[model samples]
Target: MSLSMILPMSAFALAASISPGPVNLVCLSSGTRYRLSQGLIFVTGATLGFIALFIAIGLGLYSAMNVMPGLQALLRWAGVAFLVYLSYRLAVDDGRLTEGDTHKAPGFMTGAVMQWLNPKAWLASASGIGAYTSGNDLQQVLIFASLYMPICWLSLASWVYAGAFLRRYVQRPQVLKAINRILAALLLASCVYLVLE
Candidate 1:
């Protein structure tokens, strides 16, 4: 790829990664409850998941599924279900910060699997690959993945730290409730977008 292509692609990837979405919310919650080390694991897993997603899309799997409206619907429902589950957990969190309150950071395998069920992850990966990838050249796809995934990882970390910084102020019951509600609403909106799309 030309320098022109690479720079623009990288910029696009970074913007997409940094945008507010389900994964970022989850990372934020994780960071607030736990430590950055655990939050970074989530970030790493998510980044690898995006890299794998780019590979799958490059292999034409996403396009094949894209052409099948039924498959798309199935994917949408699956994403909605997963998001609802996540939102419920967050919304009902008790106003306590006991030791071991945080769940374990999902492993790389879980993160990779969640990509298949996360609508935002799908949309972002599809958008990045669709906009930047040229032809089916594996090398180019790998190049894109290599450059993009680290941006995603770092962007997620930034959000996690931002959340951690805000956690002190937001841990108050009313503030946490509002934050949880916002997350739930966003997840619901994501679900609606998936079905409508």
Candidate 2:
């Protein structure tokens, strides 16, 4: 891909990754409750998941969905159900600092699954692939995925860092619980937004 192709692709990847979404929200929660390294693991998984999804969409998943219209609905409802489950988990959090790895914080699998279940990920992949690629060309698809990986990683990492910073101030259980609840609510709201949109 040329510089013209790369710049916009990079910007799209960064914006989509950095913007508040289910994965980013989960990363924030993980950062607040787990070690920074743990949060980064989740971020890495999420970035990989997104790149995989992007590549799949670019390769032919978008056309498949169009041919099998129900595929879209299936993805949508699956994403909604997953978000509800995650939101419930967040909502019922005990609101205590993990301080270590004993809390069973979200790990690589959860991060990957979360990205697959995230409607925002699907949309970002579809839209970015559609806008940036041409005719499902392997070269373009791979180039876009390559551009997306690090930009997405760093953008989501920044959210995790922001949450870690907030952790310092939310030393009290009530404050942390409130933050969790707010994040939970936002997750649910994203679900609703996805369904409605």
Winning candidate number (lDDT): 2
Clash list (residue pairs), candidate 1? none
Q: Write the per-residue lDDT of candidate 1 for residues 20-71, one digit (tens) a residue.
A: 8878787787666566677777778887887788788877877799689899
Using TM-score as the measure, the top candidate is: 2
Error of 2 at 110 (Å): 1.2
Give the 10-residue window scoring lowest on summed lDDT in candidate 1.
98-107
TM-score of each: 0.88, 0.95
